[model samples]
Target: MKRTNEKIAEQFKTFQILDEEGKVVNEEAMPKLSDDELKELMTRMVYTRILDQRSIALNRQGRLGFYAPTAGQEASQLGSQFALEKEDFILPGYRDVPQLIWHGLPLYKAFLFSRGHYIGNQFPDGVNALSPQIIIGAQYVQTAGVAMGMQKRGQKSVAITYTGDGGTSQGDFYEGMNFAGAFNSPAIFIVQNNRFAISTPVEKQTAADTLAQKAVAAGIEGVQVDGMDVLAVYTVTKEARERAVNGEGPTLIEMLTYRYGPHTMAGDDPTRYRSEELDNEWEKKDPLVRFRKFLEEKGIWSEDEENAVIERAKDEIKAAIKEADNTPKQKVTDLIGNMYETLPANLNEQMEEYKAKESK
Candidate 1:
């Protein structure tokens, strides 16, 4: 008999709705979305790309703090996010700020988050998301707990989380999947396999043929999708969410994608590890270009319309960064206060000391 992971790997072929040129490759897999909805998807992808570009500039100018570039993975980020309802819980990794913003986080707050402001961690009323997790793979376990809570409360919502290829190697990743599987929790796990976990290539991170096949170990549904195709990501995510809410348990989706920049805005360099030849190859499969082509073929999108969206996004991003800059400097006391409902004695003493120092 064949080994289990190999069987699972053979079953989990990469799914695609659109080819590299944005032409439909699988008509049967096309989602039932309206023309307006298709346009909306393109708008989000374009907006995210602009945001990524602006963020890189901000980081260089010292106007922003930590940032992970989302330039090439626009479809993977925005497409999966577009499939969820507002009531659903989002447990995102540090790079997933775009999803949180679209899910109701104010754009200004996202700027604040990257700036390390304490207020950035606070979610507004009715926003069902946690601040982006800085620790890799921690959100996976947290998502399991949040999904379990929703399951127990009989809420018709699912909890979804995303991590990069590097995150899949963490112990927490497997533990979260196992717990969610055992309890039949309503969770959707997405691994954005962008070929690198920082400087480490994904192949070095695991022995499995594909990240999706790891789902077999937990006895859950698994799939690989063309992450550069927005429609494909949206369709697969929607199906996974539906299954989760219906109590069919969790699904692990591996997005075959790439990031077009350094792992972070910090001192790390991508050129050292990734080759220009490889970069050019992925550039041809750029998500925005592919999706825009598809929308153009449908006669629902034009250059003028896309330009208008880009201008609007620039305006929004400018205002948000201004707001973030106007925010009062975060105090040490503020961090401590947000850390606990009731401060422990030692923390209380430190908070009082910081308050006194702040007052002076």
Candidate 2:
């Protein structure tokens, strides 16, 4: 049965399977994932936590350039990616490292990118296509274009674009939705409504009641989900993808979440605006802690098992960081070499001038 507006709103507000005490609350909606799958999710969450922490530490130590930590948003990232098909294209924002990792991007690639490696954007052999977008809302239109291309080719695959709440305010957001609606393109716009866009709160971004509701203006369905609840996010995203594949047009999803940490290592201090009390409150509702409690209630989690998973992930992430740091840096000529098949006259002239200067 199609969910009614009341049910949808309720699900959006709260679809938690676990309580703060690590207890299962929503038995029916509790994912039927096997013990192995649950363990894998937990392990991935741990790995993401470690990677985020390490990356932040590296930035502080001058070993990395800028870093965006996804520490508190692992469930939102992992669960959404898990709901996607292998052939589906993902347009990810800078803070979505966990989503890329879930899509099979190696940890080394993320480390390389964090350290300013250009080759990190190049997808590895046989890897799913995912190049991180640095511009706030640019990926929205790009993903819509990709989905339009897929529609033209009669492909059933969909494109899922991830962005922050602040991105929704950009003109590209509306343009993408309009285009998708006009052509019934296979696309899903996922707004990870993390409450704050850098230091600006969501209240300043818009007053549309909710971000998802904006889809109505574009003539598409809009849905909101409790992003902290992995199961909830997966359920809604999977349904949205199915709708797109079935030619029902695109769906806009606003995932209500919070960024517990600073926007990025290079950004303004979050403490200047956000209260530390609110941060502590969010920590109490940490997705990992909630999910673990739910799993424990089902007799599927153990302390020993969790410890082993953490230990293994720590080793893997440490190795990946080392490999990324050790990888050879790109040569100076790589900038010109990676360009189009035929260089423009202006570019050629600049390159020649640069070479002449170097020779002198």
Candidate 3:
């Protein structure tokens, strides 16, 4: 029997396990995560929180370029990344440092990248992932194409593409979804619905009741999960990837999360639109705090251990910032050289003219 809109809506209400007070509301359905795994998740969550805060500070001090803070969205980011296989490709948006960190990107490398160092583009040898995509919805198309290529090769890997609510408005989003559906490509389009695209709220961004519903038009299944619940995000993403690998086509997952910080280090004034009270309300539901409490209740976390982890993460971030700052600046000629097989006559002449001016 086909389900009605009300029935589907009731079934789709965000999947949640851990409650705000650290209690497992749906303990039976929760994954059998070991004590060690819980500790690891808590540590990663704390590390990400510290890194996000440090990045904001670095931006303010002019040490790094404009950055989007991932403060309140660590659970969704890290949990989704952790659920993937090492061979699976991840296409992360600008606000997904936690995922990159969990994927073994060093703190120094990420910091170097944030500081606009060229070496940041050079992933560790053998790491197939691309640098974070800043052009919003561009990664969606690229990821879909990559997934199609993998399918042709009979590779069992899946490609996970992350984007925001605002990105859903782009034509490329629908195009990528359509291609993935038509080809039955192994890809998962994860929309981290943080409710705002810069200053624009989700209400103004689209008329759709839920981003997940858009997947129906693309001929794929869609699921809405509570992005703040790490376990729920992990489970849903894992299931989606499994389906994709089995030739069930792509899945669109809308992770309902909230970003507590400003959109970027640049001219964004979140305070202009969002109130302090709302920020405080979200803070009470902070993923890190909730997860920490859950771990504590499970006897996997303690104040001393948490404090030690925080101190270590702070030291690591400070060292990475220092190393990134110390790296040599990129040469002016390298920029034009890296982009083309050979510089055209006009570009060559322009470069020479600039060099000559500098020499004078």
Candidate 4:
């Protein structure tokens, strides 16, 4: 055969409704959101970034542990989660704590979870979020099963899972996406392609051209969006949720974004593998800066408004920290009590022995 190009142009272009300067690129595809609604979206994005900043600082100060920073990925995470209904379920990865909080996980509980406390997994009634998954790509399979269960119960809601570019390489990713397509499960998969799976560049992870196209083999609709553009991500996710609940089956979304910091607070360094030029380039397309520009132009946002939002988020974080600190620490007894429906005599005795020693 002669050297020739295959039919690949159809999926090469990235789908983005908003541009870097906060202008809507496609008017027809623009979401019909009001001024207040738009401000609310920007507020959440700002809040998440601030939260990340504060939490990372806390971790550095030895007050917290095990955090995956979400600084540059606010648009992809918050935008998609904002599109979901309250009844919808979420299966988030370590970096999706912001989305988990939006879905009802309290900020303090998130902090507790980061600190390795069991109470961190606890949530008040009516909250439909799951504990953050540290194991990569596991949420995909879990989401598929949850969606199937919802259908069996005749519920009208859907289940959404998030992963990264590296997660697409996991077998669980394929299994989950394929199961959803085959069974018509109400599951939406969000792949935040932040260009690096930890310190490894995404190009080294796969040669599939785009992470969105990974869904094609599963017979699902896949689209790539500007993950830095909040409007574009929200639009795509909202459409996908509607399609899922309307019995149209699954959709895969690849959000093109970047992570400004390390993969985790523990043992990674961005500067070790990435360059200042690349970081500066991505900094220009920051989700918060672009959205703020648009809202300021629309006369719906101002320096005062932004500062107020920041103050509000900081206050909330402070209150959450206080609440978390005041919470009764998880004891040795809870470990045995929560492990089984009926406690075995030997384990119960051991738990009581430890409890007695602690009381003394």
Candidate 5:
């Protein structure tokens, strides 16, 4: 058993491009992206960091509802999303709003979703994503189904989903990968293993040496990557997407990342379960910090450019919050009505009854 675990671990060595000091350790693994493209990736990460900060503040002030902070996982989230075409489907977990927004979900709608407003679930034309799934690992099965649909339609698009280390323990995670592999579904399952699932550290989540190795049971390809290295994340995702679209079946990517904040704005306290020293250690590997150094070394990024993006993000976030605030209060009737295309007779009556009461 020990030897078997060791072999799996050896096979799934963590792929990394940039090291902690923002130096490229694996030159061969560096992604081929234009300077502008690199800057855009940095911009997205910075903007998302600002967004996470503002969201935490908003949640505190009672202006927003449930929020999962995305501070340290920017590279893992945006880097992968950057590899996706707009047509690809994204089924994100509650912590993955950044990916949804980048994939074309309106920022205002994301804010609305956090506020529990019905409009938040309403995607505009051309946006191909489901709202962030709050139930852990639920999106896994859904991604498999969506990918199978894409395969049947002979579309080149892939279905992608994100969950955390804790989510890997869920049955849906395995079922999704198994179904996708069985049908050669064009799916990408990403596990952002950020060391902890709420108060439970990942070590306590499972006995497996690594989450990526779990893909072997489903007969799918799996690999772990340095989630702090944006370029590495993007490179791996791009390859996985290519493999998916080319009928090579699904790939399960485990991003070795971290969340610098609590699990959620709903009262998770990381300090209660983790150490300040550990937090400080992950901070050294902050995605934005290292990616910034890499770009700066190439003369493709500067503090001025980053500051501008930060200011723009702040402005946009302010406007989005205002728009969310201006939205009509979510009604029970709206929820019931949107729950189905054709409401059942019982639900139809309830919808009507609620509509009447709401009107009053």
Candidate 6:
């Protein structure tokens, strides 16, 4: 007899191994890593936080054109990103800079992207990540196509895509999920449910009780995880990657987390949509803070180590900014040229105009 007792489709439960106070609620369920590995996770979280802060400051200074802040969702993004293979393709949304960086996108290239420079579109030779998709749920469809290609070639490489709670609402989200499911494609879909999709909160976005359940219609497995717990996220994502590479299928993960700042650097006031008290309450469960405490307990982290890591992060970010500054500016003609092998008449005319102007 087929059982229907609390399946993922029937009811999605938030998976968590760690508590807010850095204590393991389920020791067996927690991912076991060496001291060095644990320390790496802590370091990456700190680095991501610093990077997010730096980008926010740069945006405010009019140095960046458009950037999304990924402050409180470090564990959600980084932990999953760490689980992927080097050859895996990453289809990222705008708020997923840390993941993009982890997937071989240089820090400077990401900065250039925020600055609206064309150089950001170019990835390192071996890196398989794409530039962040500005359209909300567009990456979903893109990832599906990529996964389909990987499957046809019988390559172990998979395509992992990320979206927000808002992305789940788009038609592309369903279409992508459905296509992957039908083909049993090698793809992983991650939903970083950071409570708010811009000014609109998740509660208002859908009537569904859990975002993970959305995968049911697509005939794929989905689960909800504590986005604040790096270990839990790493475990789930690593297992998901293995399954995809092994030809099991795609999975949808909904990470329950919060965004501590405004949705974007476009001057949207988070305060107008949410309360200070709510933000303060969520701060108690900050991913970096909790992970740092865990590492300290393992005797792998200390005040000195933490300080050094912070300084290193700052230096790395400084170097990225310098690299971006030193790079040549984006050209109008290049933009028009890169779009297609055969350009339309209007774009050709525009490119010619720019070329003539540049020749002056």
State in Å the error of residue 67, model 2: 1.4
lDDT of 1 by residue, 116-200 (tens): 9988888899999999999999999999999999999999999999999999999999999999999999999999999989899
With a 3 Å backbone cut-off (N, CA, C), the pairs that clash in candidate 3 are none
Lowest lDDT block of 10, candidate 4: 1-10
Ranking by TM-score: 5, 1, 4, 6, 3, 2
lDDT of each structure?
A: 0.93, 0.80, 0.84, 0.89, 0.93, 0.89
- After superposition, which runs of candidate 2 have C-alpha atoms over 4 Å from their true positions? 1-25, 349-360
lDDT of 5 by residue, 1-360 (tens): 988898888889999999998998999988889988998999999999999999999999999999999999999999999999989999999999999999888999999999888889889988899989988999999999999999999999999999999899899998999999999999999999999887788889888889999999999999999999999999999999999999999999999999999999888888899998999999999999999998899888998999899999999999999999998888898789788999999998998898889888
What is candidate 6's lDDT per residue for 238-324, written digit by digit as tens?
A: 988988999999999999999898888787899998998999999999998888887778787999988898899999999989899
Superposition error at 44 for model 5 (Å)? 0.3
lDDT of 1 at 153: 97
lDDT of 3 by residue, 1-360 (tens): 235544555545677887777678887758767888878888888888888888888888888885889988988898888788888888888887668767777777887778666687777754557788999888889889989988999999898989999899999899999999999999999999988887898989876678888888899889898888888888888889899899899999999889988888788889998888988878888898888888777777899998998999999988988888788776666566666798899889877876776567
- The positional error of residue 345 in candidate 3, measured at the CA in angstroms, is 1.7
Cα misplacement distance, residue 254 of candidate 1 (Å): 0.4
Any idea what lDDT model 2 has?
Answer: 0.80
The CA lDDT at 52 in model 4 is 93
Query: Which runs in model 3 stand beyond 4 Å of their true positions?
Result: 1-11, 351-360
TM-score list, all predictions: 0.97, 0.91, 0.94, 0.96, 0.97, 0.95
**Model 5: residues >4 Å from true position, as ranges?**
340-353
